[model samples]
Target: MHIKPIKTEADHRAALARIDELWEAEPNTPEGDELEVLVTLVDAYEETHFPIDVPDPIEAIRFRMEQQGLEDKDLVAFLGQRSRVTEVMNRKRGLSITMIRKLHEGLKIPLECLVKEYQLVK
Candidate 1:
């Protein structure tokens, strides 16, 4: 086991290659242990160097709406009235805490996506 911290892009690439090689490693074995450790190190390195931003709250909502074949009218139960839903979908309004909770509960949109700070259209 020659594991090292993935500090550079080259190191990241090598770790990924190693992960591919170990993709079929059997569990409870030395090879699998190495694979797990390498994957953790690579994940930590990528999280620092190649951080991914959370999706915009409205966009997340829109994506879920699309996935579930829902129209704006369907969001009224979570977002309030039709006008409020339109305001939210148009980016003219920000989600209130209550709306965020309702959306998470009713639509199963991730709270992380719903709670992210997003710019409202002026």
Candidate 2:
């Protein structure tokens, strides 16, 4: 098993191809070990070169609300009042730190996701 650090795009591609070839490798075998190491290297390379942005805070909230089958009115418990929930959902108001904490605690949303900056409408 020839393994190396995934340092460049070409190296990343080659590692990916090898991982695909070893996709069905049985655990505790040489091929499986290679696959695991290549996956870790590819993940590290992607994290550095193709970092993903956190979702917009409002969008994350909306997505969670949808997943929970919740309505705007349901957000009052986390966001405060009906009007505030409307303002937040409409991007007419920015989320305060307190509100972010409440949303994170009450909805099980990640603090990072809830605290991401988003545009406010005029």
Query: RMSDs, each prediction?
Result: 1.5, 1.5
- In order, the Cα lDDT scores of the candidates are 0.92, 0.92
Q: Per-residue CA lDDT of candidate 2, range 8-97, in tens?
A: 889999999999999999988999899899899999999999999889999999999999999999999888999999999999999998
Candidate 2 clashing pairs? none
TM-score of 2: 0.89
- RMSD (CA, angstroms), candidate 2: 1.5
Model 1, 62-116: lDDT tens digits are 8998999999999999989999999999999999999999999998889999999
Tell me how far the alpha carbon of residue 4 in candidate 2 is from the true structure, in angstroms, after superposition.
1.5
lDDT of 1: 0.92
